[model samples]
Target: MSDEKSKLLQMVRDGKISVEEGAELLDAMDEPGTKPSGAEKELKDRFLRVHVDSAEAKVNVNIPLSLLKVASRLGNMIAGLIPGEARREMAGRGLDLSKIDFEELMNLINQGLEDGKLVDVDIEDPVKGRIRVEIYVE
Candidate 1:
């Protein structure tokens, strides 16, 4: 591997920057004449944040998409944040949290996917009462 690429990955692994930042830096390296400036870089580093609110639980997950290798682990952690009752409701609706492919999602984002509110679901849970689940890439 090229030293630049290795260094970029190391910075990501060390939590010095997010995977998106590392990828942008590597892309700048490849071009050798262009770099994401100010506003562009600011937009590139936006996060995918999840918030689940309910009478019984309030969960907030901020995903920086750091290191593609750990995307699944992050997904799992996010899934773990949802309360049991809400998880069951989500599963019954055919939305299996365990199967979410965060790596693919990251690819789409890197390719210049527009950022905005991605998901917002509000429901009445039997145990949790009024519940709302929100997922957004912003």
Candidate 2:
């Protein structure tokens, strides 16, 4: 570890600096002009990941949080990419992608969402076996 970081950790451990303050100092050393209070690194470096697994197939998708700045366009592309059968299934489950406010969701996520799963869906398909869909922020 760098001496600066070691000293910062010691300060935090000694109660001379709060965790948030120490984090901000670290952020300042890493990036000169990053937003603070835990949102700095998240907004710039976090990602949203989607994993779909089934007996027949497995798919993994990773979208950087920075790219979500264009959420509206991305949302349309994402909605359009779903297969018709999957779209219909989602619609039947009252999850119409068209009605989702992706921009707003992105904004809310930017405000504070840390690393965690946002959605987890399990479906029992007659032929496809157990299918699982997981969406998480990382």
Candidate 3:
């Protein structure tokens, strides 16, 4: 326990500062040391991370930004094309596909759509997995 830390803790305990204020004080103290260290840069240069799965053999596929736009457009089109019940369902869920950024996710759905395995698609905001697309078969 450094003298300064002990004093800060005492002040917090004595109600001179709130716990949140104490946290902010500690964070403020860190600002002077926030500069990037050269060693960190060197380490980053030496190491890169790649994600992989063993179950499904990886297949390379390129999805253009244009494709995303097209998918979004298609979703909108289907939203209009469907009957009221389907549209209401889509509207209730608020499907929006642009939120899905994981290449694997896109590839899986896209492949499913092409293969007839998926009859519908729904899109949503990425964070909450919101519905963004609704696909249907004739």
lDDT for position 123 in model 3 = 35
Candidate 3, 91-127: lDDT as tens digits: 4666433333333534443443332222253433334
- Stretches of candidate 1 exceeding 4 Å from the true structure: 1-44, 66-69
Q: Which tens-of-lDDT digit does each residue in 18-135 have in candidate 2?
A: 5875676566546643223355344556766767676655656555565444333445445554544555676777776556675677767866756898776677777656767676
- Poorly placed runs, candidate 3 (over 4 Å): 1-69, 89-105, 109-114, 120-138
Instruction: Indicate which candidate wins on lDDT.
Output: 1
Alpha-carbon local distance difference test for all models = 0.65, 0.60, 0.35
Which residue pairs in candidate 1 collide? none
lDDT of 2: 0.60
- Cα displacement (angstroms), candidate 3, residue 64, comes to 13
Off by over 4 Å in 2: 1-42, 55-57, 80-86
Which lDDT tens digits does candidate 1 get at residues 1-138?
754367557757876456886676566556643333343344435667789998777776555433332435556656776777777778878776778787577667767778787666678856558878788887
Per-residue lDDT of 49 in model 2: 70
TM-score of each: 0.61, 0.56, 0.23
lDDT of 3: 0.35
The better-scoring model by TM-score among 1 and 2 is: 1
Residue 126 of model 1 has an lDDT of: 65
